[model samples]
Target: MSDSKYAFEPAQFKVICVPGDGRCLFRSVAHGACLRLGKPSPSENLQKELADELRAKVADELVKRRKDTEWFLEGDFDTYVQQIRKPHVWGGEPELLMASHVLQMPITVFMRDHKSGSLLTIAEYGQDYGREDPIRVLYHGFGHYDALDFHPSGAKSKLFQK
Candidate 1:
């Protein structure tokens, strides 16, 4: 991973790369969810399965919250939900929001700022759940996302330091 002026020290966090299948976002979230739960990382096959399950749950959550979400989504909300249910479909901010609601946990998205040459928090979801330990994901500034985990030694990220 490239150095980031705003990132935690390389030793503080490890970036776990997931398959680049269109489901990268969901896979990353699933992987992070495992870490958050104090479980070992799931196998690649398990991750894919978890991603699919999460996708389904997210679709359901979207339908359940259509009144509050339809305004921001593009095109027909029903169509969006159907499209997202497919395994190859890629998810973005809307899906992430729904995932947070589905899992009832906070999710934090980070990205490298090209201009500042630093990693930065770009978006967050599920703040109502709490902020103590969010499911951390690093967006590659494109369409890809990877999970972030602190070292087992318990070193904290400087980005979160006071």
Candidate 2:
């Protein structure tokens, strides 16, 4: 196996549906995260609406599967993880940090296969402006971390979703 590198990279996401719903089905194939919905592009405010709807759906789905609720929880969780979890809470321009709050949900990380699109890679660790080393926040903590480390790979190897 190849060694995983801990560095900043743009995360990717794929929209999918929940299993029984003929129409309410969305999956983030890249990340193995699945979702179920009732409509296709259901609302006029598509982007924001989907984020809100998916936020709840993703949380429910993660909970049902005994997965950490990090992927599903949004808003405060994102801010807390991106900002406070790492020992160093103030890294770069404060203005850039503001943009992080704008996202309604956690961005799924993806690794593209040779065939075509990207596959989801569970984000076990994240970078913060204040800390020199990446922080491996606990998914169960909703982005909270108890310690700081400088390992190349953020979290323990066993943490990936699948």
Candidate 3:
């Protein structure tokens, strides 16, 4: 694959296959960084709702693709979510971070278990691109291993880590 294939193109969509179990690596388009529909609120529920919307968009894509492969959402938990929302609060401000010309669109899939909010893959669809966007695809296949030890397939690193 060429570099452009991995690079971001507004017209193109990127697919990241995050593994739920060790077996199937589910896929979802790497939508641009998460942005609040309104000002940030002090409610965790609000954040969760926003995340759900984003994840729903990804899920909707999965359904349209009809690939029948399980996909997942990956992120650094709430810490990262807040960080992205208000990067200035942390050392790496958003302006500076964006100045670097790369965006770390950290996303967490909204569907999750009642206990652990860690990475998860659920069934649903939310976004519709109308069949035109650059596409990025990833896959994971490790069915025999236990869930605790399972990992995403292919390169074991992040997609856009600077």
State which candidate has the highest TM-score.
1
Lowest-sum lDDT 10-residue window in model 3: 141-150
List model 1 lDDT by residue over 10-105, tens digit each. Answer: 445677889989999999999999999999999999999999999999999999999999999999999999999999988999999998899989
Number of backbone collisions per candidate, in order? Answer: 0, 17, 15
State model 3's lDDT: 0.25
Question: Which residues of candidate 3, in runs, are more than 4 Å off?
Answer: 1-42, 67-162
Stretch of 10 with least lDDT, candidate 1? 1-10
Better of 1 and 2 by TM-score: 1
lDDT: which candidate is best?
1
Model 3, 46-152: lDDT tens digits are 43343344333433443443333222223433343444343122111122222112222222222223354232332112223222211222222222111111123
Runs in model 1 with CA error above 4 Å? 1-7, 114-117, 152-162
What ranges in model 2 sit over 4 Å off? 1-3, 6-44, 67-162
Ten contiguous residues with the weakest lDDT in model 2: 21-30
lDDT of 3 at 71: 27
Give per-residue CA lDDT, model 2, range 1-162, as digits (tens). Answer: 113423322122212222221112121211121111212333323533443344344334433433343444444655644442232232121211122222222222223343442232334222333223221221111221111111234344332322
